[model samples]
Target: MSLRLAPSSKPSTAGSASVFDTSNSYGLHDTMRFGMRQIASEVTAKHPLENRLAEWENTQDELKMNLARNMYGMHAPIKMAMERSLVIKARGPSMLPRSSNLGLDILVGKDETIDFEDFLNVPELSTDMVDVHTVMEHQLGIRV
Candidate 1:
């Protein structure tokens, strides 16, 4: 024969202490206030590159390193392989957009035809593409 233990008859207030106390007993408001004060003190006591600012500095350093690597052709082989893989993957059979003569006539005059070559030859189109390429290159440190 075995005996079973009885459950406690005390009131259930397990998670109530941390959630709804405006008196600052165990709520998040006090914790956030303390953390903000600590961060402010540290910022005031140290150089600009201390603590959280160090993280930003480290990120900038990493971006500079990646830029140097790309400039020196260290990532060229991997980049080329990835480009080739993407090209091969995209060349697989896929549905092409249906050609609607009415839509084409509306877009380009009935006497004129719009093709990829004609699109590329458009000055405004080329300028927009160049602007996008320039911005991306500036951000990524790699020419498109």
Candidate 2:
């Protein structure tokens, strides 16, 4: 190996890392003669450049994720959870007089409707005045 000195724009001082008067004790060498392409190549990387290595690792992770997604798709429970989240998100005005959340209705698992009590904060119904048709349908699973 030959001793090589790399010139710097900054002046070296006793406090600084570089030494101006002698061959650097550190194994620093000029690699410009080897060409940038030679150093950039992965097959014979002169030194493992950290920035390039990190970029390559990120690209590899992305490729693996895409491949897995394309082959097996999202897991069933995760897909369901995502769909549920989307359903709960606020939607713009659809059919008016329609309450999307249903306030108390949605919590009770009612779909596509707003109950009498839910329409503009009507007072809660008394226990003695339940709808006979809804009660029968709920209990017997058949509409009168």
At residue 32, give the lDDT of candidate 2. Answer: 44
Write model 1 residue lDDT over 1-144, tens digit each, in one string: 112122223322342232234236643446553322233432434443343443543444345445546676667545644554564445321122223233334422343656674456655434334455566567678964
Which runs in model 1 stand beyond 4 Å of their true positions?
A: 1-52, 75-144
Scored by lDDT, model 2 comes in at 0.42
Model 2 over residues 35-65: C-alpha lDDT tens digits?
A: 2222223243233354445355344434544
Task: Report the Cα lDDT for residue 136, model 2.
Answer: 55
Model 2 compared with the native: what TM-score?
Answer: 0.20
- Give each model's whole-structure lDDT: 0.42, 0.42
Error of 2 at 140 (Å): 46
Q: Give TM-scores for every candidate, taking all chains together and pairing residue i with residue i.
A: 0.17, 0.20
> RMSD (Cα, Å) of candidate 1?
23.7
As for candidate 2, its clashing pairs are none
Candidate 1 residue pairs that clash: none
